[model samples]
Target: MSELAVPAPSRHQLALMIWLAVFPTLTVLNLLLGGWLGDLPVVLRTFVLATIAVPIVVYGIVPRLHRLRARVLRGPHG
Candidate 1:
């Protein structure tokens, strides 16, 4: 069987992809936690919260999954 390919990158393309993927959510989160700073319309807040949930789920879940994967990979002998 073949191994999965590691992700490859061009610096500019990678940077652009990351910013595009994450920027709007970050912006919304800032507003969610603020009053004057976040004085966004209600509709915008709804969209932001929905978008922000992705990273929130990843943040909450990824570390636990990472640790579990590490433990399994390392086995009991480690």
Candidate 2:
């Protein structure tokens, strides 16, 4: 049995990927929350953002990014 070769990203690359994913997530949340977020305390705001962002980044965006990366790497057949 042959396994596909998938190289893991380095620490810096992983950090960059996470930052890329999170920056957009935070931006959208900020836009959606708007003035309402300002009324909440910092901790509450952070909690709320984390709650919403985590699943989106984990289950949603990350998978898509992985698939996209695979497709890109695989070229036409992918």
Candidate 3:
């Protein structure tokens, strides 16, 4: 049997990637929902934010970041 050739990121790297993806997503969500969500209980607000942020982070931002990882890592010093 042939193995697939995909390279998996380490646990630390995956955490970093998720952090990068979630930060901006959560920021935007907070900005958009702040007024409406502010009155809600902390747990409920967090749940709503997570619900909206997860899909966007997983399906949208994370993939784009992975695709651009090399260039992003190169930075201005490169």
Candidate 4:
């Protein structure tokens, strides 16, 4: 019998998707927050801050944790 194979998301692919998702949200938030200039609402300002913050956290923190988990569970090759 043949074994069934499943596709998985590569690190790069996952990163790209995350980046894709982050970008639009950030852009909207950026526009909402005056797009790096002019006056804007407080809620929009907060959203803008969140947009910047979420990417940094994802790029820096989430990936690091994933790497650690991969190393422990699946070894460094992953």
- When superposed on Cα atoms, how far off is each prediction in RMSD? 10.3, 2.5, 5.7, 10.1
Candidate 2 wrong stretches, greater than 4 Å: 1-5
The CA lDDT at 56 in model 2 is 93
Model 1 worst lDDT window (10 residues): 1-10
lDDT per residue for candidate 2 within 1-78, as digits (tens), equals 443555666788667777788889999998999588888999999999999999999889877776666666666753
> Residue 17: error of model 2 in Å?
2.1
* TM-scores for candidates 1 onward, in order: 0.35, 0.80, 0.76, 0.39
Expressed as tens digits, the lDDT of each residue in 1-78 for candidate 3 is 543343566789889999999998999899999999999999999999999999999899989877666445655443
Cα lDDT of candidate 1 equals: 0.57
Query: RMSD, model 1, all Cα superposed?
Result: 10.3
Query: How many pairs of residues in model 2 come into backbone collision?
Result: 0
Query: Which structure is stronger by TM-score: 1 or 2?
Result: 2
lDDT of each: 0.57, 0.80, 0.83, 0.61
Clashes of 3: 0
Clashes of each: 0, 0, 0, 0
Where does candidate 2 clash, by residue pair? none
Give the per-residue lDDT digits (tens) of candidate 1, residues 14-40.
Answer: 565455545665665666665643678
Against the true structure, candidate 2 reaches a TM-score of 0.80
Better structure of 2 and 3 per TM-score: 2
